[model samples]
Target chain A: GPKVLQIPSHQIIDMGQMVTLNCDPVSNHLYFYWYKQILGQQMEFLVNFYNGKVMEKSKLFKDQFSVERPDGSYFTLKIQPTALEDSAVYFCASTGGSSYEQYFGPGTRLTVL
Target chain B: QQQVRQSPQSLTVWEGETAILNCSYEDSTFDYFPWYHQFPGESPALLIAIRPVSNKKEDGRFTIFFNKREKKFSLHIADSQPGDSATYFCAARTEGADRLTFGKGTQLIIQP
Candidate 1:
């Protein structure tokens, strides 16, 4: 099975600090996505990116959040000036465009203090 | 509002018994339904899935029963084992859409 890898299993930062979560999606995958899961809650879609642009985003994707996969490198989600409510486990997923199934990576737990 | 909904916040089933988890969606455009299971401290993994074109899909002991007209689907784990205990999430995506809408997960406990 193809695997997606996420950097930093866990992260802790001050409320106003910036954090970047990196994802190494399956090499042949073209569509990428980011999801947020708070403890004891369901996972929520944050945004989806394809061809260097955002295709769709949920209301949970705040203005402070951004995503990019520059130069075919790692896809990243950057949060500037994080807030307390941003504390959650972030999971990265990707699809090869041939099927609707999206493979997920081990999540990166983000904690904002 | 949640586009997808799952019932039974938590369930306890005895080993060797059958465990059924239910799900429903509000969006009629959603054509793909996938059920993913997550062990504690682990990411969700696709277990079984079904499209509206089919009323049923099965793989090993896991089966997905889809009711397109009713806008509902369910995952059935037959001959359950202790290892089957995990949080199951039901998700849906419309054709040509890459983002998935997930239902609130149902935590299943298979008692031995």
Candidate 2:
């Protein structure tokens, strides 16, 4: 089975600080996605990336959020001026263009204090 | 409004029993339905999925029965075991869309 890896499984940050969550998607996969899941709540889609650019985003994707793959490297999500509501598990997913299945990482638990 | 809805926030089942999880959606355009299972401290993985073109899909003990007209679907786990205890999330995606709209999730506990 293929696996997607996330760096710093857990992160604790002070409010108003900048945090970058890194995801190493499956090597051969092209589509990348980011989702936010608050405790006891449904997982919400934030954004999806392809061809080195954002293809779609949800209302949950605030102006403070941005994503980039940077020359086929780790797909990164950067959030600035982190708010308390940003505290949640951030999951990264990837898919091969042809399949309906998307592989998800273990997720980075971001705690904004 | 929630686009995807799942019933029974939590469920408990005895070993060897059948566990039924229900899901419904508000979007008629949503044609792809996927069920994902997540264990504590892990990311969700796809358990099974179905398209509108098919009314049912089966994989081992896991089965999906979809009703496009009713805009509902369900996952039936036969011969449920302790290992089947986990949170199940039903999600729907529009055709050719890369994102999934997930239900609130249902936690299943299998008693021995």
Candidate 3:
């Protein structure tokens, strides 16, 4: 079965610090996505990446957020100067193609104090 | 706009009973509907999916009933077991769309 792997299952950071979340998608997948879910809220799309470029992004994806798939290795999301409101569960997903289903990772829980 | 909505925030049923989860969507362009199940501390897994062109799709005890005209769909779990307890999310996506819109979610508990 195809699986997506996320590093640092849980992270706690102080306000104004930087944090980077990493994801290793299925080897054959071509599309990668990031979603965020606040406690008791619906999951919201953050951004999508394909072919080393950002395909689409939602308003929730702020200027402090950046994603990269450098060297075909880890796909990472970095946030600079994290805010308290940034606390949530971040999920990474990948799909083989447009029509294929997206496979999700266990998620990284970020708690900002 | 909330593209997708699900009813019954939570449900509890006996192991041998049938659990019906309801979902509705507002986007007419949504062509793909999928149900995802997630256990505590785990990522969501794809349980079943259906296309708008089909009225129903079944795989084992999991079934998806879609209504293209009404923009509604539901997931039916037959012969439910304790292992089936989890939070289920209804999601909608369209062709060429890079992201999926998910409903709030429904927590189902199957008691043995």
Better of 1 and 2 by lDDT: 2
Cα lDDT for residue A60, model 3? 92
Q: Candidate 3 chain B — worst ten consecutive residues by lDDT sum?
A: B92-101
Candidate 3 accuracy as lDDT: 0.93
Residues A1-113 of candidate 1 have per-residue lDDT tens digits of: 88889999999999999999999999999999999999887899999999999999999999999999999999999999899999999999999988888999989999999
TM-score of candidate 2 versus the correct structure, residues matched by position = 0.98
How does each model score on lDDT? 0.93, 0.95, 0.93
| Candidates ranked, most accurate by DockQ first | 3, 2, 1
iRMSD computed for candidate 2: 0.8
The alpha-carbon deviation from the true structure for residue A44 of candidate 3, after best TM-score superposition, in angstroms, is: 1.0
lDDT (C-alpha) at residue A26 in model 3: 93
Steric clash pairs (candidate 2): none
Please report the candidate that would top TM-score against the real structure. Answer: 2
Question: What DockQ results do all the predictions give, each relative to the true complex?
Answer: 0.76, 0.86, 0.86
Candidate number with the higher TM-score (1 or 2) = 2
- TM-scores for every predicted model: 0.96, 0.98, 0.97
Pick out the ten consecutive residues of candidate 2 chain A with the lowest summed lDDT.
A95-104
List candidate 2 stretches off by more than 4 Å.
none
lDDT score, residue B111, model 2? 100
**Model 2 C-alpha lDDT per residue in residues A1-113, reported as the tens digit of each score:** 89999998999999999999999999999999999999999999999999998999999999999999998889999999899999999999999988878889999999999
